[model samples]
Target: MLFELMRKREGVYNEDRKERTENRPIEEATVPEYLVFPLAMHIGAPAEPTVEKGDKVKVGTLIAEKAGFISANVHSSISGEVIDISDQPTIKGIAPCITIKNDYKDLEEPPLYSEDEELSVDQMIEIIEKAGVVGMGGATFPTSVKLSPPAEKTIDTLIINGAECEPYSTADHRLMVDHAKELIDGVRILVDILSVGTVHIALESNTHDSVEEMKKILDKVDHINIVELETIYPQGSEKNLIKKLTDREVPAGGLPVDVHTVVVSVATTLAIYEAIRSRRPTVKRITTITGEPIQEPKNLLVRVGTPINHLIEECQGFRSKPGKVIHGGPMMGIPIKSGRIPVTKGTSVITFLEKEEAVRSERTPCIQCAECLNVCPVSLQPILISQAYENGDIEEAERLGAMDCIDCGNCSYICPSKIPLLDNIRSAKKEIRARQEEQ
Candidate 1:
């Protein structure tokens, strides 16, 4: 039975998923005059540029090489001349960026790897690494590294996270509905590589179309189960999804591989399929441009280096003045200081909140309500961790498991006192990491 007795999931908040773009088809965004590519888009070491200023590049051109084993490669999304390479404003902060002047040729570089012969597991992985496939669910971890777990860890399960639970984000949902066959093909490739015993496509109940569409495709297929989860915030998290499906808890500071499982998002899976089948690199992705301030809320198939301002313009500008512009969903997205920041691999949604909705109420003292505790998926006490950090107790915060936080921002959302609980915990986690490096 696909619907087995699941462990009663706890500490998850039922959120109103403002999936405004669910019914909208994925529209291709217009290419802008200039595109900016950031080197440090993924986790681990930043990619090193392979091309310099005045060099010509085409779509799928390798502009940057992986700096380390954990980093992914970077490719040009548009045919252009490298105009400048210097520090520029990004969603994170000032970082080394590659600015390209679009030639408007719409030319594409030929496939680097041939797909004429059947691909071996190693060859498949190599292709993905070259394509710069990373987790598209906001964590931008190199997909090549994720697929290749340590030899000791026995991976028994592969879970495709279709639970686009973050409010106002429907990129994954649309991918499933429109491209179910491609997703299943990607899953098969992953299964061959990981040699997992079982495969499960996990989606929230809110994604009815996705579930039904996938089921239709997988009806003849075997060994792949479709599991439905409650529509809860952070239900798409790797740990929580693992717990609900396999009754396995990834220990604090551990990964899904620790529990003998692997989770790949819908967008990343599709990228893998494209990389292997057509030898296409991760040059573009589907990003949801939405919010009440947006004149047109729709899902756009956007190039990697397209600026946020271009996307805003594509949406017919704002219906009203936008008070806050975020890189992803409101719950856990980073606030974009400028629209100049280009869309990275992990960007799934660009949320524009009106002035009224973006207004922050004054933060009051914590009331010991413990609502944060009740909603924390990882069971960490945000109150204690935040307090420890406030008192300059970095070690204390570490001991309280500040590093285990997924930064889901549920604590701050549930806090009745309006405390910036998530911010403090994030600060504490950062300090803990810095001190550890010092040691």
Candidate 2:
């Protein structure tokens, strides 16, 4: 089954690459004039604002301080003047932002540490948390917390996810190609922190070039292994990858750590390398700006607080006003009503879909074909849960296994009748959570 899945993925990837090469656009004429930095981009308690309106801030300067265990700090992306500190439109919708007017001076602070100081495991973890590094792969979970697992949970493996499973997102691919050494170094750092058994770098079979590049770097180290994965949807998922490589199923409602494993994305590892080596927090990320409506598509090293509109402008603006703008990949990404939202750590791609592609026909009655059941990675009956939610039967939905759904959108993507099985199932799950909270 896995072999067939891998063969199909290789075909899809080749087709996608050919199409991208044919449709790729030229460089845009204009660069961005300003970047609106949002103060509350990460999860958990919002960072405390350190700069007020009209304050002059330099690039890499801390603009907000971490407020809690789950939160990360915010930094200035450019050397500029703080024009305003007020609610502004962002990619996540309108939120409070620190609007900075660029001076284009390009001023930056000195490095946080000298090259002579080879940091120990304890020192690296402290620097990572202080620098506010999070999972840049999309989850935005605090890196510090992930490094500190309980004593009872023995971490035996560290998996580096280079799957790049989503279509039209090439940030991870480009990183793996260009910075394989840094990624391997970051994996070493993680392994040292967890005192793990071995490190496995998992790349999709479609990205054979990247896998080879990573293998060359890992050959120098003794503990690292490069594992090729089947090119299936959600192959990059922590649970799925854990199961595929280690044959250890993360029990339902549990985490990969429960199976004595840890998964980190390639981008996240690169960020760790930067945080410890350069003593820099995660103020910027590599983002892929692409789609049919985009004038040009290229992987960009974008600042965290940079607005989506700014990125589009950098790409020479859209060819036409897209029917819809998605913040990440089409399958799991959320639809953005406006492009003015600021990019966060979890923002991997800004995709513009044309009118024809964005249109979804009205949902029809399910035919009980059980197709959703067959494709589900978690083996949940999406139809039953969705139907229960549509009828307002919350308890019935829970009993039918609404909570087991990973919300990967595979069911909706594969449905023949265009029924929004994932949407309805998600709604049911939300209600179940609310009910549990009320109790």
Candidate 3:
């Protein structure tokens, strides 16, 4: 009976999703006026700037060099003059950025590889590492590091995340439909590199067309399977996707690799394809500009370091006062104070929410309704962890499994009393990690 109830809920969710997709058309945007590429977009050590102010750089020219194993290379998105290489606002609050004044010259850098050349797995890994390619789906973890796991841990399955379950984010959806070939090539590259036994492309039932398109392409190929996931909030999460697809719970305080699996985002896979096959670094990404305030919602292939303001203007600027400007999707993205920040490799969307939609009410006491727990894909007790945070009991929170929270924001979404469950849980987790580091 319980299984039947769950199936009924999933069916209703799928119906609502079909209606939404039917109403929206996948639209694309033309090139923007200017792109502000930043130096330190990825997580590791900031790339060292190679070009100075006033230097002319061509598209695909290396502007910044990787400084460490965990870092990624930075490149010029357009053939332009280096207007300035100094501190500038970035999507992650503020950071040093390289301002390139586009000359619109359309000059190209020498091709990194010839079309006829075929690279071995080692060569591909070397190219990807040097290109500074990282996970483009917001995690920004160095892709090479993930590809080079320890020898003892045998990898059998490589899961490509196409779920894209976040609300108001369509970059992945459009990419799957538009760049199907590149995505598939990327999957093949990963399969070869990791020597994985099988490849699975997991997409939510919400994106049936994307699945259909992918299936049409994969029909000719072997060993690649498409798994349709239940349309649920946070279905795109690495842990949650692993659970729903394989029925394998990633052990608490463990990673996906611990269970003999590796998950990569569709965007990251595409980036890998470009890096290995084309010999290009990750210097730009597709960002969706959409919201109530946005004049026209569309997907743009923005160069890394393009200022947020340039994108807003390209989208015909906002129609009214925007209550908040978020760099990624609404559910898991961080809200930026200003659009002056430049785009980065990890940025996938620029969302502007109106006042009514953006404002959050004050938090209230938990009513012990257990809605959060029920919806939580990780099965963590958000109410208890949040209570521990309020009372400043770090150890209690840790003991109650606060650290296992995936920070997917589903608990916060399901809470009726407006409790900031994920936020508090994140705080508690941070404190716990800090204490461990200090000790």
What's each prediction's clash count?
0, 4, 7
Task: Report the lDDT tens digits of candidate 1 across residue range 1-439.
Answer: 0011112234444445455688998888999999999998898899999999999999999999999998989999999899999999997799999999999997999996865777889888989999999999889999999998898999999999998877789999899988899898888889899988899999988878887887777745558998888777888888889988999999988999999999999999999998987789999999999998899898999999999999999999987998998899887888887999999999999988878778777889988987788788899899999999999999999999999999988888777788888899988988888898899
List ranges where model 2 is wrong by over 4 Å: 1-31, 113-118, 395-404, 429-439
Q: Residues 1-439, candidate 3, lDDT per residue (tens digit)?
A: 0011122211112112122222344454444556676767887788898999989999888888888877878888788888787777776546677778788886888767766788887888878887778888888888988898888878888999988776677888878887888899899989999988778898877777877777777745558988888776677889977877777879988988898899999999999988887777776677778877888667878777677887787777878989888888666787898667877889887777888777787777778887777877777888999999999999999999998886777677667788988789988998999899899
lDDT of 1 at 148: 87
CA shift at 70, candidate 1, in angstroms? Answer: 1.4
Question: TM-score of the candidate numbered 1?
Answer: 0.96
lDDT of 3 at 194: 93
Considering only N, C-alpha and C atoms within 3 Å, which residue pairs clash in candidate 3?
Answer: 35-306, 36-305, 36-306, 37-305, 72-132, 73-132, 284-304
Tens-place lDDT digits, model 2, residues 156-255: 9999888877766777877887778888888877877888877888887777777777778775645788888876777777877888789998887788
Winner by lDDT between candidate 3 and candidate 1: 1
